[model samples]
Target chain A: MNPLLSSIFSTGFAFAILRVMTPLLFPALGVAVSELAGSVNIALEGIMLISAFFGVIVSAFTGSLFLALIAGLAAGILMGALLAYFHLKMKADIILGAIALNMFAAGMTIFLLFLFTGDKGSTSSLQSLVFPEIDIPLLKSIPVIGEIFSGHNVLTYVSLLAVPFFYVLMFKTPLGLRIRAVGQNPHAAESVGINVDRIKLYALMLSGMFGAFGGLYLSMGYVSWFSRDMTAGRGFIAIAAATLGGNMPVGILLSSLLFGFVNSIAIYIASLNVPSELIQMIPYLVTLIALAVFAIRAQRKRDKVGEVLEHFDPEAVKAVVKDVIETEGDI
Target chain B: MEKFILKYFTLIRTLIAILVGIIISVVLIYIISDMPAYSVRQFLLGPLLSRGRFANVIENASPMIFCGVAIAIAFQAKQFNIGAEGALFLSAAVGTAFAVSTGMPTVLHIILVLLVAGATGAIWGFIPGILKAKWGASELVASLMMNYIAYFGGLYIINSHFRDKDAGFLVSLRLPETAWLPQFMPGTRLHLGIFLAFIFAFLGYYFLYHTTSGYEIRTTGNNQKFARFSGINVVKVVILAQVLSGMIAGIGGMTEIMGIHRRFNWQMSPGYGWDGVIVAIIGRNHPILIIFAAFFLSYLRVGGQILNLMADVPSELVLVIQSVIIILITAEAFLSTWKNKITIKEAERVEVANESVAQ
Candidate 1:
């Protein structure tokens, strides 16, 4: 077999893909939740960093895994609330506020790290509580396929669980319906007595919760250590993955896996005869091309929307709405 | 006087926001430090106590002013281009590579190097802008993604072509003497690039206010549908603004390479791009005001560095202060509404008294 085919079929490579994709899945889900609610929280980068630092800090001092996890998620929620307060209460632009928060997170984490450990780098001095890996009852005993799927970090399974959890919450719950209604047609939703701002805030909170989970996984589950600015644009990579995936649960998983596979390949190819710089550029170049392709696809989709919009019957829509309103009144 | 106040409302509000930011920082310093009063005093008036420190502030502000102008220009056109960081690195690498590898007359060589750098940057920035104009891509995401690409691409070039094997570090070879920007003073690090930054700021102001193109860009930004209705090519404006923004950032990168290091260095960006975002916002996207904003930010940076060296303090306190100020200032409904409410109450009272006197 050729080297390319051999690499593709490698068992170790498959494991690396899942390991890398685990951290990304949470943030990708978070991005989906926020985008579904009409507010893009660009502060995922900062939120993950701050939460990761705090998670490790709490895990080290308390030596309690569960409390550290809660602290991480709480830190993310606090950042999310700050964004909501600025955008909702203070009337700051969401994008700009997010950028500010990101800068603050970068500076604050390092500053606090310095104060706590007296080290300007990674928090390696303190021993952090680790989230142990799990081996499936029957899967680990099987052949290569079982080896690929089992014996992963506990958070990997949590990330997998979150996808179904989000799918249900997004499509099967009343709050999810309200969020979708507000995101799609805010004026119509508001006219029906739905509180738009509250829904958006709740959506942002959920998004923050997912982001915090990702942060906790990075520090506590993935590697059991915290480093300054360790996320290293992984949050951005999550954004790219979410965007590429079309912001759906299944799509996000596939996209995360794709990017993770690409990332693993990038690492694998580093041992080749080519320059390391070229090796590093592989993932980013793919990301840029993917962006262009996504943009093109969206453009084509929008043009189709115009033709569909032209066929709208105003009177028929009014009758349908009236019938629904009459049924609601009867209820 | 009333018209003047209306004209400078953003400036006045910014000042108040900055004052509030400083007060909060003082409290933070008090909490974090053993000697709060001394630290606060040093933070406020530290740069002036030494000539070198003051020069350090000016030197640092040079790149900020250039990048700030670039951001302000892009923001004025509503492009929201955040790829200036990548554009800065790529253009400088291109400029320095050209300068070092070429053999030409002094002036022409420098001019060519600069032009190449600006064009590189403009092309680098135009990708996202054109994509947004033509296909309605999210400019923010496209620009940010482009940043990572540019960063890695620049590093690739530096390592492959410009590696100075004798430098004991992964940096580029020194450029020809023709490309080195002259120092403003014998001993200080301040160089001729600062004047270029000042000129660009003036150009930025003039470009936004005086030209017909400026009017078109602003109109397009303010209301795209209205601009289309008024026969302005909204798409072209969007693309052009980002192109210009990238070009300016690229030049800033080139100047930074020539002015400070006199060599092509591949050091990680000191985050001048992010700093420019705050500076542009603090200046309300105005040119002359951005110069002041950049200098003020640099002063705080120098003060923070001084404290870091003097008392083992982290320089990140400056960043916290900057983020708070940007957040508050950008929150128009936060402090401005209160200011307007007070002004309105005073006006109502005065009008009531005048009516009673007339009766």
Candidate 2:
């Protein structure tokens, strides 16, 4: 077997995919939440930057990981509240407001970075703490599964746990129902005494929380330093992930895993004779193709529904319409 | 006077937003800078103090004008196709291949390079446009993904085929003299691209406001369902808007390369496409207004550079100010009460005038 092929086939490669997918999963989950609320938080990019920056700064100065985590989460939630004020209260365009926040985060982080550390690129000089890795003793006893799942960073396990947590939160809770109702129809939600603005605010804040975790993982677990624009395009790619997943918990997990697999492959192939730039293009190109396929399928589904409607029996349609009007009148 | 104020309410609100943005920057400087007063002075006065510095403003604003108009055009048609960044990068690389390898008459060479650049950009725009039009894929995400693909793809082409090994950097061979845009001033890099930028802006204004297709684009943008009901082809209009936007962005890239760099050497996305968004927002998505917005943004950028060099302040401060202005100006309710008051006053005056005429 070829060396490259052998390397790819190992349990280590599966572990690499899981490791790479953690950050993406967090933000993609965030995107799904906010997108479900009908106010997409494109500023996950900025929120992640702020959280990552504050986490490093607080941890480095105070020497307390807990304090750093609090500070990071607080910063992200505050950004979400600011966006809510701008969009819901001030009637600003959500997209433009989010774009502004992204620019602010990109600028203010670098500006404060220089002010604190005298470095414009990264905080490599600071001795930031990394989150500890956990080994599942029972899982470690297994052969292939143990190698792939044991001794991973604590956040990676948390990310996996988050999927089920997200499913419960989105499906089983009253707040979740209200959020979905608000997303489906704001006027109807409002009429039922569900404060649309409040629900949206909650949704955005929840998104910020999830995005903050991703940022913390990037700065603390993935590497031991805070870097300028370190999120790169992962924040944007998460939007693609969320959309490709149809904004569902299980779907988001699968899509994020897919992206992680492609990204890890891109990383592995860099050692080959192929130009690294072309290899770098693969993940993004895959996203474009995936998006197109998703859109086409969705379109076909809609057309099929239209076809069904067109072919409906007139007598059955009339009976259903009359039944709905009678039921409304009785109400 | 009340009527005048009411008519220009949006303009007034925008001016106020800009003022607030400047004040925010000043406060930030005072808090952050050791020598606050000096930093503020350099930021406000540095660009206007020197002839050469002012030229930098013009040189910077030229490409911004092109991009601003491009953004304004696409935005007018309500297509959030941010692929201008990708189109600019990819087209510049393709244009450079022509600029470096081909030997032709100066005028013909320039035209050929620009046309190829525009066509390349159009293709970039067409992808997202058609996707959104046909299948409802979000143009915003599609275009953004395209930017990275273009960046890496362009880099691959440049690194593998066009890399000048002796240049000591990852750059293409120097552009030939035939390709350079004519410079207006001997000392300044201010080139004919500035005039071309102005021409393009005017043409964009004409195409968007005067032509039948422009009407269709605007009508579709204003209300897609209504436009469709009125017999307009919303799909075609959307695709056309993206393609035209990409073409304009492509030409802008060509101008930047032809006007400034001696060789094709952009290691990272230069971010002019993003700046064009700010320009379009500030200009309120109007072609003519975008020129002034470009000049204003370029002035601030130049000032930031000077402040960085002289006062030791990071120029990223300008980005903070730009974002604040964008958020405030786009907020519909920001100055709504004041606008309403002005409109009420104008209505009262009109009623009084009518009563007096009847008497």
Candidate 3:
């Protein structure tokens, strides 16, 4: 077998995919939540940045992992609330407000980083704690599966659990139902006495929490520092994943896994003769193609339905309507 | 008085927003800096202190002016295509490739290079535009994804094909003198691109306000279903707006390369594209006002740079101010009460005038 093929088939490669998928999974789920609430959070990138920065800073200073997590989550939720306030209360355009928040996050993080560590690029000088890895005893006894899944970062397990958590939260609960109702039709939700604004606010805050975990994983688990613009378009890529997945939990998980597989392959191939830049382009190009294909298929379906309606006979429809009316009168 | 207030309502609102942004930044500097007064002075007065610095403001504003106009046109059509960042980077690389390899007369060389750049950018914009117009895909997501692709794609081309091995860095060969944009000022980097930027702004204004196609674009943006009912081909308008916007952005990229850098060496997106979005928002997506907005932003940028050099303050502070201004300006309820009062006064005055005439 070719060396590249052998390397790809190894258990290590599967582990690599899982490791890479963690960040994308978290943000994609976040995107799904807000998208289902009809308030798509375009500021996921900024939220992630703020959380990543706060996580690193708080951990470095307090030496408490729990404090870091709380600070990071709080920062992310605050940003989500700020976006909601601007969009819902101030009547600002959600997209523009999100864009503003992104810029604010990018700038604020760098400014504070410089102020604290005297370095603008990253927090490499500070020593931040990471979430511990856990090994499942039963899983550890398995063969190739053990190598792929036994010992992994706690966040990785959390991300896997989040898929089901997302499903139950979005499908089973009343809040989830209200969120979906608000997303599908705000006026209808309002007419039913569902606090549309409050539900959306909760949805966005939930999104923030998920995005914060993704950011924390990046800084603490993936690497031990926060870097400038280090989310590196993952937040944007999560949007594509959510859209490609139809904004469903299971679908988002699958798409994120696909992106992760591609990302891992890109990393694997970087050692070959191919230029790294071209390799870097592959995932984004794949996303664009996926979006286009999904959209085209949807369009074709709509066109086929339209064609069916266009060919319907007026006399047949009128005859059916008269028969239904006559049957009702007889009853 | 009511008529005057109504006429200048937007201007008043925008001014207040800008003032609020400045005040917020001032408060931030005061809290952050030990030498608050000096830092504030440097931020406010540094851009006007010297001719070179003032010229830097103009030079910086030039590319942004083109981008602002491009964004204004696209946004007028209600297309949220933010691929200008990618389009500019990729087109600049292509333009540089042409500038380095081709041999031609100076004037013709510059024109041809610019045209090629514009065409390249149009292709970038067309992808998202067609996707959204034909398939109902989100232009926002498609365009955002395209930016990353454009960045890496441009980087690949430059690194593999155009890499000047002797330069010890990722950069192309020096552009030919014929392709260079001529300098306008003796002691500064100000170039002929500034004039082109101004020309493009005026042309954008004319195209948007004076042409039938412009009307179609605006109508489609204002109300898509209504435009369709009125016999407008909205799909065509949507795609046209994106392509035209991309072309302008492409030309802006070429000018930045030709006018300042003179090489294809940008390691990252230059961020002028995002600045253009800020400018467009500040100008309310109007072409003529974009020029002023571009200048205002560039002035702040120059001031930030000066403050950074003199007071150890990071220039990212300006970004904070810019975002604040954007959010405030776009907030519909920011000063709604004042606007409502002015409208009520106008209505009352009109009724009084009618009664007097009847008497």
True contacts kept of each: 0.66, 0.86, 0.78
| Best candidate according to DockQ | 2
The residue-by-residue lDDT of candidate 1 on A1-331, one tens digit each, is: 9676598688878988998998788888988888888888888888898899999999899989888988999999889888888898889989889888987898899888887888878888989888889999899889998889899999899999999999999989999888888877788899999999999889888888888988888888777788878777788788777877767899889888987887777776666645566655665666667778877765665554444457777765555446544643210
Question: Lowest-scoring 10 consecutive residues by lDDT in candidate 1 chain A?
Answer: A322-331
Instruction: Order the candidates by DockQ, highest first.
Output: 2, 3, 1
Candidate 2 lDDT over A80-163, as tens digits, reads: 888988999999988889999999999999899998998889999998888899989999989999999998998899999999
* Candidate 3 C-alpha lDDT tens digits along A65-104: 9999999999988888898999999998888898899989
Listed per candidate, the RMSD to the true structure in angstroms reads: 4.3, 3.7, 4.4
Please provide TM-scores, in order, for all candidate models, with all chains considered together: 0.92, 0.93, 0.93
* DockQ of candidate 2, scored on C-alphas against the true complex (2 decimals): 0.68
Predictions ranked by TM-score, top down?
2, 3, 1
Against the true two-chain complex, what DockQ does each candidate achieve?
0.59, 0.68, 0.62
- Model 1: DockQ score: 0.59
By descending lDDT, how would the candidates be arranged? Answer: 3, 2, 1
Per-residue C-alpha lDDT of model 3 across residues B31-111, encoded as one tens digit per residue: 778899999999999999999999999999998999998888889999988888899999999999888999999999999
How high is the lDDT of residue B345 in model 1?
Answer: 70
Every model's TM-score on chain B:
0.95, 0.97, 0.97
lDDT of 2 by residue, B1-359 (tens): 88777778889889999999999999989978899999999999999999999999999998888888888888888888788999999999988887889988999989998998899999999999999998998898899889988899888878788889998889988788998887879888988889999999999999999999999988988899999999998899999999999999999998888988857899898888988889999999888999999999999999999988998689989989999999999999998988888888888988999999999
